[model samples]
Target: MKKRNKFFTKKNGFICAFLAPGILLFLVIYAYPLVNIFATSFCRWNYKNFQAPEFLGWGHLFDNYIKMFTLDANFKMALINTVKWVVLTMVIQIPFTLLVALVLAKKPRGWKFTRNMFIIPNIISTAAIGLIFLNIYNPSRGIITEICNKINPGSNVSVLADGNYAFWGVTFAFILFGGSSCLLLLTQIFSIDPGIYEAAKVDGASAWQIDRKIILPLMRPMIGTVSIMAANYGLLLYNEIALITGGGPDNATFSLSYYIYRTALGSTKLNFARGNTAGVIQFILGILLVGCINKAFRTDQGD
Candidate 1:
């Protein structure tokens, strides 16, 4: 019994030793920061109170939350824009990617080349893409100004200078590049058994019929997965807006992530508590979004 106990202890020790690094990494990288953010969000931590946070009394505990929804115009705009981004990604980006994936699955002429070309944008750094779009939107020497001049000579219209155009400009900068989403959909398409396609063909089904009747239903889970990814990207958008518009033209293009950055670090005031509060809200919204998506896509397997 003593020998058996020693052996079991040694085996457990070995297993724990292997798990310790991963557990420690998760605690340090994810859990600790999340707890700290939630804790700091209820405090009054700003540039003036940098070293430590002052706890808000119970009466004033909800001040930051109330301010974000009621008093802060910029936060309202950011929230609205973030919702637009999420909706646009779900409506436009995912469908476009799914369409492209369906087409590429057909393996037409130059399909391989087209697939590789489509992925180039996603492979390149987002910062590089943002810089490229910024130059393209420049009024002085960019192509857009040249095109405007062609249509109406001497017209120097800056795409990023006007609020309405600036919003769409930021949208177009990242909206059309759905290569990663396309890749995911294409993988799902190819994973379908060839026998299924052959069976559908034998049953007098056309390509479109096969896709609609069989492929789409089978691809629901994958679509939901990709939708979540794209939605999260839209919700947490920052880099493209930061690099391209800098939330300019009357702060028309601010996203939730950008709002957090501006509140916590970018602005002179450095309101860490407010930023963390936004972070908590963003986190809760993300959870709710995932839950809704999962429920929508859940399959009914009646036994």
Candidate 2:
């Protein structure tokens, strides 16, 4: 017992030394900002009073939150768009990546080449990808316009100019490029023991049965991990809208992140308090999303 206690004490000192930097970094970087935003959400800190945040009285503590839901049309629209994007990530991106991972796991002819090609988009910088899609939706010199003209004879189909099309244009720009997530899923799938597959084959298990019963079940934790990442990306999407639509065609493409920027920093009439309030809501939503995905996947039960 004395030796064991001494061993643990020595190990604990090294563990504390290893953890100190990360804990300090988190406090300075993430925790401080989160606390600051949550506190300032109940204050009035805008261009008019930029020196310091003036706290709203106790009775009016929720004034900023109430104003967001009641009086702010832009915030409502941004929230709705953000939620839609999250749903799309779950419905489209997760499934599409899983499908690609499953297909590639079979090691088909040229599977390595195919996997490399699929991952190219994800490896490219997001800003560059945004610019590429922006030009693709251009009216005069874009492939889409040329294709439309070819099909319909003199039709000029400008995608990003219209609100509805702009939304979809932004969606398609980032939605299908789930290469990184697919790679993670593939790694998880490949890590399964080969002996299990051989035994299943001997037991008359078809490839489909193996994939459905064994692969899918084992990949749940990884799916949840990638889902959280994809969902967070969708929720905090800003660069695509900034480069493509700029929330244009009558403020139709406004997302929460974009809304926060415009409200707090981008616009002439900066409302820092309101933006912080939105940030608080976004923070809460992210926590809830992660919790829900963790529950759905039962990631805690993993081997």
Q: Which predicted model would earn the best TM-score?
A: 1
Candidate 2 residue 139 Cα shift, in angstroms, is 0.7
Residue lDDT tens for model 1, 125-203:
9999999999999987679889989999977889999988888888988887988888888898999998888988998
In model 2, what are the clashing residue pairs, if there are any?
Answer: none
Show where candidate 1 strays beyond 4 Å.
Answer: 1-8, 152-155, 299-303
| Alpha-carbon lDDT, every model | 0.90, 0.91
TM-score of each: 0.92, 0.89
lDDT of 2: 0.91
> Candidate 2: worst 10 consecutive residues by lDDT?
294-303
| Candidate 2 Cα deviation (angstroms), residue 285 | 0.5
- Cα lDDT for residue 116, candidate 2: 86
Off by over 4 Å in 2: 1-24, 203-205, 301-303
Top lDDT: which candidate number? Answer: 2
